[model samples]
Target: MSRIEPPSTDPVNSKPARAATGDGLDPGGRRRARRYDPDRKTRILDAALDVLAEHGAAGTTHRRIAASAGVPLGSITYHFATLIDLRAQAFARYVEQQSAVFEELLEVVRTREEFVEILVDLVHGGPARYRSAVLGFELHLAALRSPDLRVLTQAWTRDSRAALARFTGPDVAARLDALLKGMIMNVLLATDPEPREATRAAIVQTLGPADGSRP
Candidate 1:
């Protein structure tokens, strides 16, 4: 055996590489080695959505998501264990992100027509717009199959219904919620080629005109 070199004279050796503890966070530092970054996770989720939109469900992978997120490939596993986990989280995030738009639209409208106009705009053309309905379908499909996802979906439905009811009153809120969700589902399915305006009109008809009075 060659004479044992007195430990290599590298800076890493001289300084001794610090290992992250049980928390995966450096003891003296604020950042964690294996912990998820909220910003990074959001970016990764968005990138994952883009990848899914471009290549469908099966085309997305850790490397692709990492590339999209502009993070190292190793960080993917650090944040998510399986593709399903990643997909589920991404879908959940998408739903949560979209809800803000719906809430804002509902908030501004004083009447049912105004509400429907906003609804139509949101469905037909809003920020985070998709070229095709596949991504929406994919998320809905995943939620349909996963109880965890369904819980989140149901919460969204309940919250949305409550918001609409706040403006439209309990008497019509349920019906309005059903119409709005149904319209979105129909659009996602692509079975109804009718303009979103038609769906909005249908919802307005269901509302039978806004009372324009706070309950």
Candidate 2:
């Protein structure tokens, strides 16, 4: 059963006695309708993502997510059938959000140098967040074990590479995507990162001089 929160009291006290809850009628054994919140599910999913980023999939629980979301435990069961279901939906939401982040990185690139610099910044940790990396790592690990998650992973990879392929072509974009992932992981784990110039040089080396060459 859900906990009924007590309503606020007025500064001046009245002669008449009042019920603890203003949520519904108290006397005469009256029943009340459930409260409505249109955005509760979205908030739950967002909270689940936050949980996933902070803790791995294994550590994410319905109670944990409910507490993070400030929703009731019943809400978790109401929205998702199982923990795996909730985790999978949360992972999907992360991918959707990250797709936008990835697209924003390439939105203003009109030159090879601009692209190279963006890649360099990415390699050197520009807009990327520790939380994003943690979520990505958890998603990848989960996908490895579940074929269902692999579908989402594959689609994300395809879209990400396609975005890059707009500038670097399919072949180089694939390699660059792989390189970027590796370099990001290296940067995340390294005690001290290499010079920013080294990152730029690596990107420039990957792209080669601008020839407007067609594959």
Worst 10 residues of 1 by lDDT: 1-10
* Residue runs of model 1 more than 4 Å from their true location after superposition: 1-38, 131-134, 188-192, 212-215
Deviation in Å, model 1, residue 136 alpha carbon:
3.4
Name the 10 consecutive residues with the lowest summed lDDT in model 2.
1-10
lDDT of each: 0.64, 0.75
**Tens digits of per-residue lDDT for model 2, 125-165:** 64447678778878889988765677667767887898899
Q: Write the per-residue lDDT of candidate 1 for residues 100-189, one digit (tens) a residue.
A: 656776667775557667767655754355443467666556666554556556656666777777777776888877776666666655
Cand. 1 Cα-lDDT: 0.64
Q: What lDDT score goes with residue 207 in model 2?
A: 70
lDDT value, candidate 2, whole model: 0.75
**Model 2 spans > 4 angstroms off:** 1-32, 126-128, 213-215
Clashes of each: 0, 0
